[model samples]
Target: MTDLVLGPLLRHVGEHTAAIWVETADPAEVTVTAGEHQASARTFRVHGHHYALITLDGLEKGTKTPYQVESDGELVWPLEPSIYPDSVIATFDHEKPLRMAFGSCRTSVSHDSAGNKLHGVDSLRAYALRMSGVTDTDHEGDPDPGPGMRWPDFVLFLGDQVYADETSTEMQTFIEARRDVREPPWAELKDYAEYAQLYKVAWSDPVNRWLLSTVPSAMIFDDHDIRDDWNTSLAWKQEMEATTWWHGRIVSGLASYWVYQHLGNLAPEEREQDDIWQRINSHDGADEFDATDLLDEFADRADQEPESYRWSFTHDLGSQARLVVIDSRAARVLDTENRSMLDDSEMAWLDEQLRGDVDHLLIGTSLPFLLTPGLHYVEAFTEALAEGAWGQRWTDIGERMRQGIDLEHWAAFQDGFHKVSDMVLEVARGERGRAPETVTFLSGDVHHSYVSEARSPRKAARRRPRQQSRIIQAVCSPIRNQLPTGERIGARLAAYWIAGPIGRLMVKSAKVPTAPLRWKLLRGPWFDNNLATLEVLPHGLRMWWASGKVEDGVHHRPRLITVADVTIDKPTKETR
Candidate 1:
């Protein structure tokens, strides 16, 4: 690897200081040169990647601080003309509520024109490259502006940041170059070496690494993080359990996820106290142990003992409120009889976290709380089929479906789904504590983007205003994945006409009770790779989902595919 990209990463303006962490490509003496101060750290291998964490203290809140890093007494990267100074902490008078860009499903691929056609510039890769000051020149001889424009304070990656199953062309090439594809385990990410290479491909790019170095980010995983249709249903789990190479696959996936994704989610305090990585970081490069073995043990433990580790994390931005990022993938229940989207411990953690004391409560899950109307009903009905709830006559059909099954998200695990839904509603109703102005569920998966409103079904019986009884469901997906043209019609047919009425009818037909809400799509399922920014104001929330318009060209900014502003009216004294 080359010691080329230098970043002032994990940067935040704290109450008294501006903090930052950095990674170096070589064991070089790294220094941060800012306005009046400099800080340094020795580049050392943590696990295997070379890194350095540096903090610039005593920064004035909200004041921009320009910075650069030196390796072995030389500036390692070009000074990007448009990079932010150091962390600009939010102050009491900072008017912008809290604005963040969020979305998921990015695949690692070359950013050259050929790869760009398939993957596009909305990718984390391009985002990183742009931030790092890499300019792409078009065939017609135009210089594309770098990533300095349109940067958000944070980018929340919802899931599938690394696809273990749907390996990109770049990832496949890396694997193919190193090993024979015909062998077991080696064929499809069978061991730790392959997993490490996968992460290196995912993060080591000049653009993305720079983006990650500067953008304060938070993330959670979905099925593609491990495999396609991961933990979709009990039968899927059993089938995988019988595979000869699955143990290694799961271990590698979870272990790599921890090192590359989950560990990066921590804040300064948490990062300091983390036991495993701390120890790993302390070890010098000469340590003889193969990290893959330890990684397998860690992955196995994380899967076998979900309670022993925490994949979910919460971020609180002063009184603006809290963001509860839940790990719906790793911490799942795959039992046939008592299935749950989140395991018992994870649910309890979520329940505790949702007992909010923030102005707004944001729940971040990789899977949407509400599925597309058609798929939603299908998942629910399928679970019923498995249990013979639709009558024993459908058992054979259910068995066959279960054998080839993979309908995921909330509806797949009715038990956990119902439990979580009840808790969220209770929180929304102020039963849990001071009800937040809005309970925003942010998610991405299913390769589409949408915004929905959940309205209380009690609207007919009780005359509460619409604002008081509504919760926002926002989804921005595949920040890169485009729906195959062939499948678009089927996905729409399943999501709209067939999925909608059939889903509603099935609920009534099954006589199953629902929450005080019915949902409707307020915005999209538009088949574009997208990125969305959500801004919360004292009065309401303003959200805009943007996707790159190829026709718009580099000169034209990303077009706003959708925009929504929701304001929650406070309950009057008389209503209370």
Candidate 2:
């Protein structure tokens, strides 16, 4: 029996359709059935691994049904009398506002007592336990937690779902058994096989697996998903290519990402239009079709020719809200003379997405668009200095430091930053569309979490009336990864106090222009393993960060606890 290998991960649910993805031990036709509705697909092989994405369409809006998976007529899911609840597919209601759980940067590791102490309890797992009503607490008559845990329409995983560069111990063991860990690629992932294993280690936990099965999710990629500071600059890319192992790494990373993460991001309509998906779906082979050459060539092309493909996508929450998930890493223009966080094509696409007619506009990028002013200025100064603003000596130093510390966020790409900032302001002022209640940047990556509020640009304010839409930045990171103790102090200093003045002076010395936007950190730079969720409500747009806490060292079952919460309410009629 070729049992399920990885998932039944629910993805991209609309009013009438949804996608369900799974991997099998062998090539098999997989099916998902919910009540009278069902969808099935034959497995397609990528480098000997078999996967199928069965998308169930034509479901009625706002309906809920328990779904089960089968691989070639074998009922492989639900486990009959399993401890967990049945995995259900819940279609989105057009009347409902958007509520989603989001964060980034989780490391795959053990979840026992030792693992808990080392890495903190997994926030995502804690969330799963809560939503599933399977808390390990011994309290008699176990009281119900709030309904909000299950309230999110879906979860949005910002990035770094799997770390290819900093492999876990299990991943390293797999690498060592296959070849020399002391080789050029070393313990880092080398191919699609390794990437497949990394995913198994990351998502195969019973609790996380259950969470994914029951709840739909959306995702994008960040640097560590491929490597630290991936595509940080032209020089960095050149340096990596000079190495012997990089081509294999790039091809494998991108190929595996497409299979595991990117494909699921698309809706049913988008899937039909995707070139690679069409290529595989059109196959008529009597046996399971192998897509090794197609996947490899596609991945390689995506790496070399950035404009040939795009990873950015958009989701509309009925007419209430819009989520534009931008691909920050791959679609980069990294040449120093024209260094930008996004290419021209991607920028034009985002300009269209940022229009504000809905109740809220949520821009999801892996890197924070509005970083703490201090860090923003530092990155701006670094970019200028690296481009020879202060002459060769400083330029070399700036380039080294930029790549050394991973400074290629939106702030580092000053041109793109200004352009997007202006676009956001334009939307806020009702120039592009009716101004939304809030324009929030939802992001994660820096190993810390915070909320910032952007003030209107001085020139824009003088030219126009006061903008009503609240401009804000919300960042949550490290669903498991936590910053070390020593570095926390440095992060605090950079975020809260002295670095702003020093960074500004440095920026002036480098002849860097002032940013088009100004913002102050409103809430935190908390260093915790947290999962943040936000809900669009009638009163305001509400957000809260939660972390897992294991009481009395009872690490096997950690409970979820809120770390911070905020609500950006709409202005009253007169104020507006």
Candidate 2 residues 424-460, lDDT tens each?
9888888888988888999999989999888676786
Task: For residues 418-464, write the lDDT of model 1, one tens digit per residue.
Answer: 78876777776777777777788999987777887665566532654
lDDT of 2: 0.87
Tell me the lDDT of model 2 at 428: 81
Which candidate leads the pack in TM-score?
2
Best by lDDT: 2
Candidate 2 segments whose C-alpha is farther than 4 A from its true place: 136-149, 572-576
Candidate 1, residue 437: the lDDT equals: 74
- Which parts of model 1 are misplaced by more than 4 Å? 1-48, 51-58, 70-96, 120-150, 185-187, 204-207, 281-294, 390-396, 399-405, 459-469, 505-516, 551-576
TM-score of each: 0.83, 0.97
